[model samples]
Target: MGGIGIMIAFFAGILGSLSASDYSQYTYVFCAVLVLTMIGFWDDRKDMRASHKLIGQLFAFFLVVVLGDIRIESFYGFLGIYALPISVSYALSIFMLVGLTNAYNLIDGLDGLAGTLGAISCGFLGVWFMYAGYAVEGIICLGMLGSLMAFLIYNWHPAKVFMGDTGSLPIGCFIAVFALLFIRENGEMHPSAVYKFHAPITAGLSLMVICSYDTLRVFLRRIRRGKSPFTPDKSHVHHFLMRMGHGHDQVAMFLGAIKLLFLGMVIMCSGLNEHLMFPFVVGLTIAFGSLINVVTLKRMRAKVRKSPPISQRYPIKPTATIKSKSTWEDEPVLES
Candidate 1:
């Protein structure tokens, strides 16, 4: 069900481009990610190996980075890091983009999570592009935002269908490109314009706080468990919520609320004090996430203790016996 919807969205964007006779750098974004969506679709149906999906994702990133020339050229003084050598910047750009793509992919563990979060991210970026007077980028962002919003009508918790890989892969690809463009745009602006108004890098990171941080958390967890980072498990944030007894819709709401709050704080604090904003928000996110984990474990332990024992839950009720008089001897009769 979701595959059909996602395909319709894919074609809608393509046909919209052709109808408008729009051929531009960002348009190639949808075109470049064909490999990713294809591999993702296959994986959904056939359950492809993780290694193969990674290879396909890397190739998609290569298409965007090398051919489309949408690489991040600077950090714009975030961490006091700027003016990287061309070689180093190019390499860093590739690695970050690929990682962002997969990180967004990882957040697709629950209904409406990818769609809700992706719509919010791209919607904010779309408005930013409009503010920056980049009509094409605005169009791309709006297009993606619209498709995701439409998909959510069906993909919402108690979902009629899912976005699957076809939807999630493209979302990750779009957001990664948008984040890079957002950061790169800041570089072209006057330094003081950034200092007084925004911290583009941190703002962009916060736009995706859920995916980026959750991916890092999941990777660290898998590593500590002596498992491959790519190994699938029920350890994602959604799984954690599910284990805590959150219904599917409730988990979606849980994450949607966090995403909104993070985006709001990032937009607000970034303008006031760009220097301290990123780390502060990150610290808060980490703290809140860890608290959730600790609380979940504690509650789980308590719940286990409070629950009825298996034997009691399925008790063998004893039968009543009735004393009976007989000529030969006393007979026992079971009583209903």
Candidate 2:
């Protein structure tokens, strides 16, 4: 179901492009991703292994580099980093492309979670590009948004199908490219501009906060316990929520809501003091932590409800049959 929606969107975008006649820079983007999307679709049906998917991501990222000339322009003032050298840009971009692609793929555990969040993030980036006059980037973002919008028809509550790693990997790669372009456009303009209004990076980071942070947290926790970070477990936020009694649909909706709220708050706070972003990040972390505690309490309540009384665990046998001695002389208590 999700695959069909993506096909329809791809065709619609192609038709729109043909009608325009005047080819745009986004033509390369659409063409480059066209093959990758098919590969993902094929893998979705065939159940590709992790190594195969990793190789596919490498190939797709190379396509972006070779065809689209994709590169990371800046670090957005983090780590005292500014412009990246050519070699660094190439390396970093590849790593980011693969990382984000898999990060989103990992998060596609519930219905509507990955698809809805992808749409919201891309839609925001599209608008930001329009304001920044990056028309090509904006069009690419619109194309992505369209694809996700179509996917959501089957991805919503009571989902008929999952996006699988196939759909999610492409979605993640698409968003990463959009963010790179967004940063390149404004990051190349002026330091002040990059600092003042970095809606694209902020939006992208905000949307995938749960996925990214959880991934990192699990990695660290696993390393601390001498375990492989890649090992699967029921520790994911969605999994814990399920254990806490949230239906799959409810968990998906709750996660989507959290992403949107965080995204909105970040957008609203972009113009505020530099100190504000830190506090917002801290607050969100706390909120997520509290949510986990609530889920824990819910699980405790479920355990309590499921537990049987001591008598049920170990039945006490009837000791004897008795009668009132005064009422019936012949009816005496008989001990068992």
Candidate 3:
């Protein structure tokens, strides 16, 4: 029953707005995410294969990029690159869509974590879209925000329901779409436009920095350890906070604050170039993650030193539950 409420609320809002002028232009986006939601729903119940899920994700994203004509057309001068070739644009767009969809799913660990973060990002983007004159896209964001807020009532600590793959996949896909749109639209804004971003790419990345950074860190660690990147483990940022003795609600609030901190940094550095702002954001995130890791490790070491010797201690039984083979369905496995 993951995100069943979110789906219902979101669709109902979309339906209510169908009569708005020129709203049909965004119908493909609606359709694309709808397809993703269905795929996720199927996986939630039937435990779809990883490869099969990837195929489905790729198909949905391709429909949006190729048919809907929504994509990253330029690098925003990162690495001194501006516009991209058509083939490169298509490849980049699809890769980002699929990567982010799963990256978001991977972060859906603790109660209220995903839903809270989703609301924050969507709320920010929704306000910006409305102010920037993207009414349809803004409405989409608000619709998501509304659904997530309602879902959070039941999804708080001691959660009654999880978003699972069903909610997270489409939500991630939806956010990725808006992020790309933000970059493209902001770049094309008139020089005098007040709401235009000086570093659109950086701002877009900031909206998703937490989940993106965690996913990259987890994958790199897995590769360094000579294991599949998708292997399950307790190495996420939320896990680190838990190891340091934070409650579920506290961890959710802390991560939410980190996200807002990143957004604040982006706003404060609005005058900087994308190349400069990009590395600054990445470095700040790395520094914070490293700090958390060091603290967590030190605490664990201290606990070990205070415990009885291994030879004298009673053997402890494993309390971890056995997860399924389906990576997308498992509790600990990385979906991306």
Candidate 4:
């Protein structure tokens, strides 16, 4: 599995002390990932309850936060926001982490969907990490990046192997860890890396634009329909694309390509003012949300039009008063 490969790499780093910035803490990361993967594999084998799975995710988040020292300390001055109190940061950190973990898991439906997107997201984040002189985290990112690329070979359309929870859970962990680290202000920015981000948080948002937005879109939709937000359904963004006539590989390609485009834009716009980049990112998210909604509605209408009419479905009977003359009309009967 892809996660298994990354786990080995992390172990190697721990044994060799090859990481910079004390990135050698992959032992903690590896242990945390093993727990997550176990829970995921359990779910794949026996369909674990949503609450239990969430608890596992929380445990993973807690481990990284407490043991790995990976927690939010600042929002990088977004909206003039500065340092958060210890308690508030803990709560906020775990919540964003658990939410994004579930978001990544949710998007892992179709063949190559999660794997391709994971590679893109982590690939760029890894490059940015090394670019900014964060080698250990960058290595972890690239570890995940390489693992996911290897995964896509078998996970492509007509997938020969599947990630299931075994892969999805840790991939989410990687994204959360890297994205949060990406947004953290580690004193001053490296000169070469400065132009790679306007506000580092925007890069995080852009890297995960589709997954984050689609997760929000589905949650709101389920709640609006009076269903639990965790209820599973075929209403994901990929489902919408499938309804629009795309196959597994095609949908994955389009979505991944789009995400890659936004990521490139994020890098390009990194030189712009944070104030400008923030709005640009938010506006793009809003636009994507609106577009998906319209597409969902269109898919619904198309489905309705394709369905048989009620009378045709039921085969409504003619009135007895007018049917007495025919041999088949003397008695009321249901049609199969």
Clash totals for all candidate models: 0, 0, 0, 0
- Which scores better on lDDT, 2 or 3? 3
Write out the backbone clash pairs for model 1.
none
Candidate numbers, best TM-score first, in rank order = 3, 1, 4, 2
Model 2 alpha-carbon drift over 4 Å, by segment: 17-24, 190-204, 222-226, 272-283, 286-294, 301-306, 309-336
lDDT (Cα, tens digit) per residue for candidate 2, span 1-336 = 265467567557846754454345555555546655777787878866768867766877877866678778667665567677878888888887777766777777877878877888788887777676666556657777888887788778788877765567667777777767755664455546643444434544565676776667667778888998888776677777777777877887787787777877877876653245655665776678567868677787878788898889999987766657764586554655
Task: Encode model 3's per-residue lDDT on 1-336: one tens digit a residue.
Answer: 567679899989877975655467877887888888988899999999899999988889988999999999998777889999999999999998888878898999999999988998899899999998988888879988999999999999999889988899999999889999998998777767878887899899888889999999999999999999999899998998998778999999999999999888787877677878888888899999999899899998898888899867967676656656774464655433
User: For all the candidates, what are their Cα RMSDs to the real structure?
Assistant: 6.5, 9.2, 9.4, 5.6
Cα lDDT of model 4 by residue, 308-331, tens digit: 999898997864444334734665
For residues 1-336, could you state the per-residue lDDT of candidate 1 as single tens digits? Answer: 364576577457856754454545455676756666788789888988878887887778877777777887776676777788877877888898888888988899888888888888989888878777777777777777888888889888678888788767766887888888887786667656633236777777777789988899999999999998888888888888888888887888888899888877776665654577767887899998998899889888888999999999899876765455552255444446
The C-alpha TM-scores of every prediction are 0.86, 0.78, 0.90, 0.83
Q: Point out the higher-scoring one by TM-score: 3 or 4.
A: 3
- TM-score, candidate number 2: 0.78
Among these predicted structures, which one has the highest lDDT?
3
The residue ranges of model 4 lying beyond 4 angstroms of the native Cα positions read: 1-23, 185-196, 299-336
Per-residue lDDT of 205 in model 2 = 57
| Cα displacement (Å) at residue 154, model 3 | 0.2
